[model samples]
Target: MSEDKSNRVVSGRVVSNAMDRTISVLVERRVKHPLYGKFLRRSMKLHAHDADNACNPGDWVRVEQCRPLSKTKCWRLVEIVEKAR
Candidate 1:
């Protein structure tokens, strides 16, 4: 039997690419307040592995979850959705 496991995918903008073969992504999502019905924006900084270092700041990219590559990097870059001007 061929079994496939799907990994989590996240789309975000590249915030930083200072580290070698690594990039930081800023994922933002809107959530409603628990008490009030106010929509608030929340952002998270995620570390992903950029094998070819093809990502740049402000570049929209998609990352898929994978085995821990590093202490903070458990996600790997999949494709560049949009490039920054």
Candidate 2:
């Protein structure tokens, strides 16, 4: 049996460029402040694999944890959640 255990990393689309075979995914999460006790927006930039180069801006995509594709890319494009309208 294959032995691969990795947690999936999901993020929203902040920018998608097929020309460079990469997509800039924006992940947003809520975090409570230590002293303020209020939720704040926390965003992160992630690079995902785009084999077919089929992705555009403003598209929700799900990325799974995988080997590093580039220096800062450790996720692969699993599927597009919603297409840009």
Best by TM-score: 1
Which residue window of length 10 is worst by lDDT in model 2?
10-19
Cα deviation at 49, candidate 2, in Å, is 0.6
Q: What is the lDDT of residue 43 in candidate 2?
A: 92
Write out the backbone clash pairs for model 1: none
List runs of model 2 lying over 4 Å from the truth. Answer: 1-4
TM-score of 1: 0.93
Residue range 9-81, candidate 2, lDDT tens digits: 6768748574477888889999999999999999988888888788898989998888887788788888998
The estimated TM-scores of all candidates read 0.93, 0.84
